[model samples]
Target chain A: GGIITQTPKFLIGQEGQKLTLKCQQNFNHDTMYWYRQDSGKGLRLIYYSITENDLQKGDLSEGYDASREKKSSFSLTVTSAQKNEMAVFLCASSRTGQDTQYFGPGTRLLVL
Target chain B: QQQVRQSPQSLTVWEGETAILNCSYEDSTFNYFPWYQQFPGEGPALLISIRSVSDKKEDGRFTIFFNKREKKLSLHITDSQPGDSATYFCAASLSNYNVLYFGSGTKLTVEP
Candidate 1:
């Protein structure tokens, strides 16, 4: 079984600052995704990549940017932190076509 | 993300009872449906899923029931255990998007 790893379990950022969250997967999957979850809310898709150098925007992609430099790694950047914002960003990967997705431990972000 | 509606934002059930979470979506293109379970400070995990062609899918204690015509679905946990206390999310995805549209989530607590 492969695993998805996300760096920096917790993050604290100041308003208007930029922050980046990184994700790495060992499953060798071709598709990866980034999602944001607020307390008591469901996960919202931010961005996804079908393969290296391929990017796709999702419903909540306006505030985030993503990169897929290689098949095993994907990264997301918060363009500008919002004051008093609190959310958790989750990363996941799945094989091509319809398949079950594996998720990584989320990165909790708080903008002070 | 894509207007997937969910009800009973939170639910409480006694141990050994059954807990049902509901979800519905407006996207007719979505052919795959999945449910995820998440614990505090952890990432969501794929619990079970069903395709649009199938009405039901079961895995151990968890079951997914789909209604293609109604554009709705549900997850039922039988004989719920205290360990089942967590948030559950229902997601839908089309073959084109390669991303899942998630519901706000349902927090279920199985109390002893």
Candidate 2:
């Protein structure tokens, strides 16, 4: 079985800093997604990529950007961090549309 | 308006009791509904899912009751245990698009 590896399990950034989180999946799934999970609030889509070099905005795409540099890797960047802005960033991959999604361990981001 | 809503933001039940998490969606186009379980500091993982055509789907101790007409669905965990304590999210989406809109989430705590 393969796993989705997310870098920097915990990240602390200064306000207004540009922070990037990386994800690598070994399942070789075609579709990848980035989601922000706030406490109490469920997962909100930030960006998704169906394939390499593709990007699609989600409902909460503002202040965030994502890229599918390669089929096996996807990354998300926070344009400008806000103090006290804390959330968990999750990376998921699916084999096909509407299929079951496999998730990574997730990266916790905290802006100081 | 919140696209999806999950009831009882937090639930506490004794071990071996039944825990029911309710969810309702306002989007009529949502053809797929899924329940995801997330432990603290971890990513949400798909627990169970159901399509609009199906009224119910069950796997092991987890069961999903879907009502297409009412645009509502729910997850029921039988014989709830302390280990089942976590945040649960209900998500909805169209079959063609992988984008899923999730509810605020329901935190379940099973006591001894």
Candidate 3:
């Protein structure tokens, strides 16, 4: 049983500040994903990578940038924090072509 | 536009009773559906799933009922326990696609 680990359980950022969230997985899965969770909004996909160095945009990818520098790691960067924005960012991974995804603990971000 | 929708934003049930959660989708092209359960301060985890071709899928106390014609599905939890309390999300995706469209989620509280 592999685990997905996310850094910085909580984050506080100022308006227009840049913040980055990191994720690491030990499942050796070929796909990694980033999702944003907001109250009453469920979860929205931001970006995903099929393999190392590969990136694909999702429905909510406009304000985020993602990187898959290694097979075991995926990272997301908030280009510019929005004021009064509070959301939880989750990282997930799965085997390519498989629908079962394992998620990390998540990082809660509050932009002041 | 949200592709997936879930009803009953929140629900409360007593132990030994049953809890039902409803979900619907707008895209008929979505052939795979998965339900994820998330506890407070944690990321979501795969609970159970059903394919479009199957009307029912069961795993222990959790069951998924699918109605392809109506583009609707429901999750039924029998013999509820306090540990079953969590937020449940309904997600849809194509069989070959890696992206998933998720519903807002239903927060279920089981009283013991």
- Name the best candidate (by DockQ): 3
**Candidate 3 chain A, which ten residues in sequence have the lowest lDDT sum?**
A93-102
**CA shift at B91, candidate 3, in angstroms?**
0.6
lDDT of 3 by residue, A10-105 (tens): 999999998999999999999999999999999999999999999999989998899999999999999999999999999999997788999999
Colliding residue pairs in candidate 3: none
Q: DockQ of each model against the real complex?
A: 0.69, 0.73, 0.86
Tens digit of per-residue lDDT, candidate 2, span B31-108: 889899988777888899999989999998899999888888999999998999999999988875888889999999
**After superposing candidate 3, which stretches have Cα over 4 Å from the reference?**
none
TM-score list, all predictions = 0.95, 0.96, 0.98
lDDT of 1 by residue, B1-112 (tens): 3578787899999999989999999988798888889998889998888889899999998998898889989899999999999999988887545778889999999999
Clashing pairs in 2: none
lDDT measured at residue B4 in model 1 versus the true structure, 0 to 100: 87
* Candidate 1 vs 2: which has more DockQ: 2
**Which window of ten consecutive residues has the lowest lDDT sum in model 3 chain B?**
B93-102
TM-score of chain A of each: 0.97, 0.97, 0.98
Q: What residue runs in model 2 are displaced by over 4 Å at the alpha carbon?
A: none
Q: Indicate the docking level reached by candidate 3.
A: high
Model number with the top lDDT? 3
Q: What's the true lDDT of residue A82 in model 1?
A: 96
Please report, as a residue range, the 10-residue window in candidate 1 chain B with the lowest summed lDDT: B93-102
